[model samples]
Target chain A: MRAAARPGGKVTIAEVAARAGVSKGSVSLAMNDKPGVSAATREKVLKAARELGWLPNQAARSLSSAATQVSNIGLVIARPARMLGLEPFYMEFVSGIESVLVERSYSLLLRLVHDVDEEIGVLDGWGRSKQISGSIMVDFTVDDPRVAPIAALGLPVIAVGHPDLTGGLPSVWTDDGAAVTEAVRYLAALGHRRLARVGGPATLGHSMIRSEAFAKAVADLNLEPGRILPTDFSGEQGARATRALLASAQRPTAILYDNDIMAVAGLSVATEMGVSVPAELSLLAWDDSQLCRLTHPPLSAMSHDVFAFGAEVTRRLMDLIDHGDAEVGAVPTPVLVPRGTTARAH
Target chain B: MRAAARPGGKVTIAEVAARAGVSKGSVSLAMNDKPGVSAATREKVLKAARELGWLPNQAARSLSSAATQVSNIGLVIARPARMLGLEPFYMEFVSGIESVLVERSYSLLLRLVHDVDEEIGVLDGWGRSKQISGSIMVDFTVDDPRVAPIAALGLPVIAVGHPDLTGGLPSVWTDDGAAVTEAVRYLAALGHRRLARVGGPATLGHSMIRSEAFAKAVADLNLEPGRILPTDFSGEQGARATRALLASAQRPTAILYDNDIMAVAGLSVATEMGVSVPAELSLLAWDDSQLCRLTHPPLSAMSHDVFAFGAEVTRRLMDLIDHGDAEVGAVPTPVLVPRGTTARAH
Candidate 1:
C-alpha cells in the first residue's frame, strides 16, 4: 500500500521480480548482493529496479550491511529566516530534539526552505544520497506534497502534524483543535461575549484546525464569532492585526494569539493605544514561553511542554529508525494557564 | 607556521613523499587523484598519508573529482541544551547563516555539547569521516582546547572570535573591547559615579575581554571599579543578579546587561522593587533584539547587526572552503542606541 502511494505509485519487490522475469526470492538475493542468482538474472533485477525507481529502506540496509549511513537527521523548515531567529517555539523544539540526539551522539541536519516543494527536493536528495539516517518533518499544510516523495523513498520520518495531514507518516502533534476549543470556552466562561483570534498562516494545517475549532466553539456557545486574522507569526504582523481589530466599531473584548511573540506584540499595541488590559481587552498567547512572564503585565497562555513534545517526536523517529515502525498519535492537550493578562470581562 | 602548530606538528607533502619513497609531485598527484600517478605509487602515497594522519584539502578534492562530499556544514555549540532554547543570540546568528546557506542550497548540521572536550570529539569525527565540507566554531574560551585538534585535522573552519583568541584560524568578530568602552563612556557621561555590569560567564573569551575593558574604562575615568557579576545568560540569572545588586547597601547608579533578555529581566526587577529607570537608576542592554522595543518604556541598547555578522561569517567560511584561505577581521562596532532605559544621573 505504501509503495503504491509513492510519487510514481507503489513499487514492490514482487513488481520488480515480475518485471525482471525472476522469482521474488531470486530478485531479493540479487538486490541484496547475495549468491545463488546468475549474473544475467542479477543484471535483469538491477535494470528493473533502476527502471521502476524503487528505493529500498536505507535504515534497513544499514542494519543488514556495513553501509556508512551518516549519523545525522535532517530537519527542513519552510519559514522566513528572520522570523526563525525570534520564535521561541522552534528554538525550544530544536533544543528538545537535541536532548535525545546527544544521548546517541547524533547530529541534526537543519535546513530552511521557502516552500514545501523545496523541502521535498531536499529530503528526496538526502534519501537518495544517504546523507541522513532519518528525518523529522514539521509545519505540515493541507494535503502536504512532501508526503508522497518522502514515503516513496522509504526514508524513516517522524512528522509533526495531525494524522490526516501527514498522509500515513508517523506523526506527533498536540491537539490544536482541542486546545482552541478550550481557549474559547475559558474566555467565554469569563463573561466575554465577543472574542477574536490572531491565527498563523492559513496554509498551515494546525492553523486551519484551530480556525475551524474556533468557529465550532463560537457556534456551540451561541456567542458572536470571533474574527480570525491570519498572520505570518511575526511580531509586526501581530501588532498590525491587533491595531486593525481594535480600530473596528465592533471590536472583540478578548484576543487569542497563535504564538507568544505575536501575543507580546499585541499587548504592546494595547498599551500604545492606551487600552486598559483585562479591564477592556484580554490577551492570551499560545506556546507559553518565558516571554509571557517578562512582559509588563504578564500574558496568559495556552501552555504545553514544547520541549517534551520535541523529545517525543525525536523518540518516535529513533524508534522508526531502529524498529522500522512507530505509532502515530497526539502527545498531550495544551492547558489554559491563567496569568495577569486575562481576567473577568468588565 | 599553521602546519607546525598542528597536533603532531609539521606534516608536509614533501615529508609524506619522502616517507612513501615517491617524488613530491607524485604524492600530490596521488592525493589529488590526478592521472599522472601510477597505481603502486598512489597506494604508497595514500598509505603514507594515513600513517602521517594528513588530510588533503577536502575542498580541492571536491573540485577535482565526483566524490560524495556531503552538502552539509557542521556547527557545534558547547552549551547546556536548555539554555539554547531561550537565547536569542544563537537563533539570530543561525538565521544569518541560513541567509547565505539558502542561496547555495546547503544544509547545516547542528550539534550541542556540554563542553569543549565533547566539541573536539565531534569535530574530529566529522573531519575524519568527511561528514561535512567545513565547519563554523563559536564560543572560544581562553586557551580553547578545541583549536589544536581542529587545526591538526586540516578541516576548513571559520572561528567566531577575535584573532588573538582563535589560534590562527580565519575568524569573524565584533570589537567587544570597543563596545565595552563605549558603553562605559556613555554611562559615565550621564554622571553615574558607580557602574556595574551583568556579564556572561567568566570563562568565555569575549566576557574576559569585556571585563578587562570595563576595568580600564573605570580607572581612566577616575571612578571606582563597579562590581561585575557573572551569569550563564539566562533571564532568571539576570533577575537574580539585578536583585542582589539593587539590594546591596552600595548599589550601582547604573547597570549594563550583556544581552537584551537580561536587560529586560533587570527592568522588570527594577519595577517590582520600586526603582525607576533613567531616574533613580539607568539600564543599558546589549545585543538589541526586538525584545528591547516591546517593553513598556523601550530599552536602550548597544545594538549590532547580528544577522549581518552571521552572514559575514558564512561568507568568510565559503571563501575558506573555496579558496583554501580567507582574511580575518572585525565585522562592525556595536553602536550605543539610546532609548528610554538610559537617562541622566540625578
Candidate 2:
C-alpha cells in the first residue's frame, strides 16, 4: 500500500486514536467528517495527528483532495522574521495578501532568509516541482543576482520591488523616491536646516532610493544634508545610532527613521538621553505601524497604504499566474500620517 | 507521457508563449527552471498562469516533498491573520516551537482561521490527510467538544491548554488561577479598595479560571469585584471597557487585562481620556508579550515565559505522540513584572 520509502513507517489509526485521547471510531468519524463526531472532538483528532507527526495516507489525501484543495503561494521575506516585524508595512501587507488569498482558498508558504541567494534558492526549489503555482519576490538590490537567476530559468513569479532590479519582471512597487522627497521637503518647510535619517540596510533598493532622494532634498534646500546613518532595521541599532547622532557637534533638531520600530527605539533612546521630543528634537518614522500611534507622543510617519498595496500586488501575481495576457504592474503613491512625533523647529 | 486527465493540457505552452511575447523555448526554460529566460520572461509565464487560471500539475507538491523531508505539525491559529500580527505571543510561541521543530526536521503547517468551527474542518479534512503528523490545540474551554472528536478519531494531539479541555490528552497550560490570585493580592496590598478585570472571551477555559480567581480575591479582600467584562480581545473592546470604567463613579484605581494587546488598547483609551497612568490610574497585563516592554514607561505585567511554554508544550506533545507513556501535561506558573504602569493606589 505504501508508495515509497519514508524515513519512518506508517502509523496505524489505533496509534492516532490513542494519542488524540479518542477512539479509532472517532478518528474514522473525523477523517470522514461524519455527523458522529462533535466539532471539538474532530479538532482533537486533528491535533493528535499533528502531535504524532503523521502525514496523509493516499486514501485520506484522495478523499480530502476531492473536496477542498490547498493553494500555495511562495513568499520569500528577504529578512529574518524578527526584523520583518519591525516594519508594520509587512504585517499590513501580509494581511492584505491574506485578505485576498483566504477568499480564494489559497495558502501562503512564507520563508524568512538572510540573503538574496538563499531567497532565490527557496524560489527555485518551490517553483521547479510546483510546490507553489507562483511566488512573490522582494528586496531588490541594484544589479541583483536573483534577477538573472529568475530570468534565465523563466520561473513564474512576481517582483514586489523595483523594476530596474528585475530586468523586466512584473513589478509592484511604492514610489520610495517620491516619498523620501516629500519627507525631506516637510522637514525643510518646518524651518529645520540640519536633518538626519536613520535608514534600513544599504543593499535594499528602497533604501538606496531614499538615500539618494535625501541627498537631493538637502542640496535643494541648501541645508546641511547632514548624515545618512544606515542601519539593519534593528531597534537596538536605531537606539545606538540615535545616541551617537545626539552626541554629534552638528546635532540636527529633526530625525527621520526608515520604519516605525526604529522610531520607537529612537524615542526611548532620546528620552533616556534627556532629549525632549518636538522641543529639543523632532522625530519621524516611515511605515507608520501602530507603534507610532502608541508612543507617548505619537510618531509622525511617511505612510503608504501598505494593505492596499499588498492586495494589489496579490491581484497582479494571481493575474500573471492565471491569465496569459494581463496588465503588468503599478507604482503606488504614499501619504504622510501626522501624529505627536513631529513639530516645527524649536 | 500523459498522466490522468489534466486541465492545463488544452492550453498548450505555445499559446502561453505567443501571448507572453516570448519564444516557446524561453517559456520552456521558465517553466523548467533551466537557464536562458530573463526574470521578466519568467514573470510573464507566471502572470500567464494567473490570467489563464492554470494550476501547475504536480510541480509544487512534488518539488516541496523532495526538499523538506521534514515532519509536519499543523497549527490552526483560531484567529484572523491580522489579529495574529498584533499579538506578540504567536510570534514568540511559534518561534519557540520552530526552534525545536527545525532540529527534528519538522515543519509547522500554520493557518489563521476566523472561528473554531472552520478549524474543525481544517483538521478533519486537510489536517487528516498526510499534511501533518499531529496538531497543537490551544484555548481550551469547559465541556470542550474537541476532546470527544479527537478521542473518537484517535488522532495524536498535544494541547497547549488545560487538561480537561484536551479531554485528558497530553496538555500544557499556564497556572492562570494562581497568576490572577497574585495579581489581586498585589493590588489589595497596594491599598486599592476596588478591582476590575478586562478578561478574554468567555468560551475560553483560561478566561474562566482567571475570572473565577479574580472574583474570589475580591470577595476575600472585602473589595468590590463589580463585574468581569469579557471581550473578544480586540482594541476597540478594550477602549470601550476602559471608557465605561472611567465614567463610573466607583472607578477602581487598578485594572487588569487578559492580554498585552488589550492592555495596549486600554493604555491608549486611558491616555485619550486624559487619565495619567499610575498617577490617576494603574494597569496590569497578563501573558507578558513584548508589547508590554515596548509601551511608554513600560507596562507592569503578570509575566510567564511564553516562548518556554511553547517549547515545553511541543516537547510534551512529542513525548505523548512518540512514547505514549509519559507525563502528558504540565501547567506553567506566572510571576509579576513590575514596570512603570502600576503603583500605590491614589
Candidate 3:
C-alpha cells in the first residue's frame, strides 16, 4: 500500500535520501534507474521514496543526468506559418498528440521552418544541446535531403511519411496510394469516364505517390487519360486550377482534391461559373474536416481520423524514446465518404 | 571590418577565449554581460567575437548562466484539446506568434491545461526549472486565480486580455465591449428589433463584457430586451442554440455569434429549418477567418486580424522580457464587414 499521508508536508529528495541512508546523488541515480546505483540500493531508495510519497516534478526529471529523462519533445514543420494555421490537419494532429502527452507531463517544442535545410540545422542544434529527448519530423519530399542528416544525429524520432521515403527511420504512416486508388475506382464505378485531379505540390512524397497511383488506376480501368494539376495546396491555387480545368472544352466530369480547403475553393469556383455540383461536376476532398460538413453540399471525402493518426505517431515516438527502437506503424487507410457531391454521369 | 573567412574552421567559444587571452568562463561572462567580467575583458571578448563571426545557437544561449538569456517562451492554454483544434482562433493566433518568434530564432513551448490551478502549477514548475524566460497568459476570467500566483512568481509575462481582468500584468488586448456595441447598433440601424446573441462561456471576462454591452445597446436603442445564450464555442453548441431560438414562439430576427465556426453552424441550422437568410433572419459572426468567406452567401462578421494581434502580443512579450516592463497595448478593434448574411428585417 502507498503512503496515506506525509508527516512534515511536501516530500523532497533530501528526505528520501536520509530515509534510505544514501547520498542525494545515489537517490537520483536510483530513481532514474541509472547504472551507477547497485540493485539493492535502488530498491531501498525506491522503498524510502514510496513511504515518503516523494515524486519528482517534470523539471527535476528533465534536469537529471540521465539523457532520456527530458520533458520536451520537438516537432519541426517545414511550412509557412500562415498556411499552417488555415490547414486543419496540423492543428487536429497537434491536439491529438497533446492528448497523450498531457498524461506524461511532457511539453511539445513546436517550430515552423522554411525548408528542409533549415529543419536540419534546427534538429542538429537541438541534439547538440540535449534540448529535446525525441522529435517528430514531417513533410517528407521525394529523395528527401533531411533523412540522411537526421539519421546521423541519432536522435529518437518518428518520421511521419511512407517507409520508402523515411530512409529506414521508424515511421507512422497512412496508405495514401491505396486511398487514391480507391477514390479513383469509386468515381469510375459511378460511370465517370473522364476524371481529373487537383493535387498538392508534386515534390511532396504523398502527392507523388497519389499521382502515380491515380495513373495506374485509370489505365487499369481503361478510362480516358486523366489530367493532373499540381498546386501549392492553397485555396487560391485550388480555385485557379479548377478554373483552368472547367474552362477546357472537354472538361472531366469528376475531380479529386488533395485537401478539403482546395476542394471547398473548387466548389466556389464551380458555383461562380454556374455549374451545379453532382449534376454538372462532381468533387471529392481528402482529409475531411468540419469545413466539409458546414458546406451546402457536404463534400464527399477520403476520410481518416487525423487526430487518431497523430496520437498513434506520438505513442510510437514515446516508445522509441524509451526503448531505443520501435516497429514501423500504420494508421487506417482513408476511406471514401460519399456525401452529396458525387453522382453518375449524364 | 567583419571576418571574411575562418582561419581554421567553425568558431567556438574556446576560440573566442583563446583570441581574447581569457578563460572560457570569463568569455561566457563577458558575452552574457554578467557582473564578474571587467569592462576591459568585455571589450576584448566582443572584439574577438566580432572578428571570428561567432554567434551562439539558441540552445547555447538558453544554457548560459544569465537568467535573461533564455530562448524558450511558455504559453499555457486552459482548454480541451478537441475544442482548441476546432476554434481557429488559437491556431491563427499561435501562427501569428510564431511568425515573430521565428525571426528571433526562439521556440514556443505550448501546453494545454484543464483549469487555472493546473495552469499555475505548470507555470510554477516551468519557473523552478528555468525552462522558459517569459510567458503569455490568455483567457482571463473574473476574479482569476492565476493573477496573484503568477505575479508572485516574478516571471515576465504578457497577459492577453482586457487590463481590467489582467490584474496589473502587462497586457495586449482588443475592445470587445466597443465591438459588441458596434455590432448591436449596426443591426438596429438595419431595422432588426428582435436581436439576440450567442456568446462564449459567461464566466470569461470578455464574454461578460460583451453581454453587458449588448444589453445596454438594446436599452439605449429603445428596443425590446434581448436574449443571450452562453455556449462552449463549439459548432454543435452553436447549432443547438440556434435550433432552440428558432423554435421559440417569438424567435429572434437577428443573431450574433461569438465565433465564425458557430456562425457557420447556425447558417446550416437555418437552412435545415427552412429559414431564409437576410429575408427571414440575419446572422453576424466574430473573428473572421477563411471559413467565413467559404460558405454560401458568405457571412458578414465583426472582423479583426487575429494573426496580427498575435504578432503584436509577441512583440510586447519580448519587450517585457528584455526591459522588465511594457506599455499596455491594444490591437485594432473588430470592425464591421458587410457580406450577404445581414439585411433589414421585413
lDDT of 2: 0.72
Question: How does model 1 score by TM-score?
Answer: 0.81
Model 1 lDDT at residue A199: 96
Tell me, by DockQ, which candidate is best. 3
Q: Runs in model 3 with CA error above 4 Å?
A: A1-69, B1-69
lDDT of 1 by residue, A85-196 (tens): 9788998999899988988878899998877656765775566556788899998889776665465546788889998898767778899999999999999999998999
lDDT of 2 by residue, A55-89 (tens): 33645456555344445676776565444434556
Per-candidate chain B TM: 0.80, 0.77, 0.81
As for candidate 3, its interface RMSD to one decimal place is: 12.2
Off by over 4 Å in 1: A1-69, B1-67
Model 2, span B1-346: residue lDDT tens: 1111113334666777777778878877776555788877887875664344343344444544444432557677666656655665666676566555644645456666666655665665544444556777876779775554454344567767766566565566777888899999998898887888998888888899889889988898899764689987866677688889988888978899988777877887788889999897889988786567667767899997777777777776676557653455455579998898898987
- In candidate 3, what are the lDDT values of residues B207-267, reduced to their tens digit? 9999999999999999889999999998889989999999999899999999999999999
Q: Using TM-score, give the best candidate's number.
A: 3
Interface RMSD of each: 21.7, 10.7, 12.2
- Check candidate 1 and list the clashing pairs: A3-A10, A4-A10
